[model samples]
Target: MTQPIIKLNPHLFFGGNCREAMEFYKSVFGGELVLTLYGEGPPDAHKDPKANSEEMKSKVMFAKLSGVITLLASDNPNNTEAENTGQFGLSLEGSDESIFKGYFDKLAEKGQITAPLIKQFWGDTFGMVTDLYGVNWMVNITANRD
Candidate 1:
């Protein structure tokens, strides 16, 4: 039997200030940062026009700060709605590649796969998803040994 080994990482969700937030953090820690915009995400991730507004399509879809630590973030494309989704999301890091895909498939079943799992410029297999409960999740599998 095999089960996914998951580690929690801080996932941030902003109205549209995700890049700003990551920039600020970078200033503090001075680490390598990688960012992806909403428009860069998979097509399925933009099905919700409200969450993928013209102004938001270019907003930060995912960001990672790898300096003193690893901090993950993104913009809440669904910001204008009545209920604010707040400024945070839960991130999951898996050690095993297979486990990572398994978790992603299971979680995405009843949720929205905001970012289709794919290879990122930062050399990581990553994706973003919003669970059925409206909780945002970011999953990553490191592509190389650091």
Candidate 2:
């Protein structure tokens, strides 16, 4: 295997909710979503070209974003289990209050708000939430907003 440079997408596998998780990530992180619906895109996605067919196309072979950051997501190949989202979480770090606040509000929507965006003991604006899909996310807004 050769080393791949410049990661274009961050692949995340789900037991069965890859699509939902990806959509939530899109809303949390600013990005354009180009999803390849199963059997809706080309047939060059499968590892085995011969296996590439309409039936395979609709498996969410690829979903990408081209903006501030490139985010790529897709469903589990077939049997791979999604990582323990609780043990692993996606953190959005920045110093912009408005932007961070905007994301915090959206992420909290339909999700459990574990912590509200307020001044923490660390002297920073921070909050935490687990989205509707049970994906844990943390958003920290530094105190020095400028």
Candidate 3:
């Protein structure tokens, strides 16, 4: 029997900083970045008058980065208090230690490293970092089981 293909992508919400954050990710991951501004949408799409304002129009309605990884994000037009707050983290695992370590270092530039990347007892290099945008990430370079 064959199983269906499944892919999980992380979607983030920012407070008027979606473009900046997404751009940063593009720089780190070297992906194709596509951003759709609120003003690009239909005029009557939003019932709230504030949503039609210039500020809102300049905000990122949708942002996507596709390459080494696929990431989606958007600005919160409703001004809600949306935060990651350690609830969950994006995890990356692979056999290439150098590649994963490079990602971990780049992500930890202006961010804090919750855990240093090192060879663990389980026989893999593991680490964690919270990026400048308050997004948590985990990287694990798996060792060959054979």
Candidate 4:
């Protein structure tokens, strides 16, 4: 038997703001955005009574932004506040310094910069930022090791 190829994608959860966050990501990454509201799903699909409420119905049930990178997100049905546990962060690494620097700058807008993009002892430019949505991101521009 042949081993099946696997692809891991990040799925983020938002508190009633999945649509807005996904839209922001689309703007940053220049991706195609696809969203499905809670009310847009089949009537029988949702088992919770509150899912029919206008507020809940307007929330994004599913959102996907596909571009250079693919991101999937959805609004939490329970409306729990999003928190950053500092357990993990999405990392973007490439050799294109300008493009990655641009991303680092844009993601830092209205957000906190954990680390400024600068050359490290490893000979690569690296930085960290927590976006306005509270999502952590790491950008690394690899230097030619040769």
Tens digit of per-residue lDDT, candidate 3, span 6-79: 98889888888889889999888898999999899888687877677787889988899999999999888777
lDDT of 1 by residue, 1-146 (tens): 99999855677666666776677656544689999887776665766786556677788878999964578888776673323453556677766788677767766766799999999998899999875445567889887676
Sorting all predicted structures by lDDT, with the top scorer first, yields 3, 4, 1, 2
**What tens-digit string does per-residue lDDT give for candidate 4 at 1-146?**
99999978899988777887888888777879999988887775777766667778788888889989989999887764666535679999999999999899989988889999999999999999998898999999999999
> Which parts of model 4 are misplaced by more than 4 Å?
80-87
Tens-digit lDDT track of model 2 for 9-128: 455555546677767767777678788765664557457653365444446667776665576666655534545556556677788899889888887888889878888998788889
Instruction: Compute the lDDT of residue 138 as modeled in candidate 4.
Output: 95
lDDT of 3: 0.88
Candidate 3, residue 146: lDDT: 92
Q: Estimate each model's TM-score.
A: 0.48, 0.69, 0.90, 0.91
Judging by lDDT against the true structure, name the best candidate.
Answer: 3
True-vs-predicted CA distance for residue 139, candidate 2, Å: 0.6
State each candidate's clash count: 0, 5, 0, 0
Q: What's the lDDT for residue 80 in model 1?
A: 32
**lDDT of residue 22 for candidate 3:** 93
Q: Which residue pairs in candidate 4 collide? A: none
Better of 1 and 4 by lDDT: 4
- Each prediction's whole-model lDDT (CA): 0.72, 0.69, 0.88, 0.86
Error of 3 at 76 (Å): 0.8
State which candidate has the highest TM-score.
4
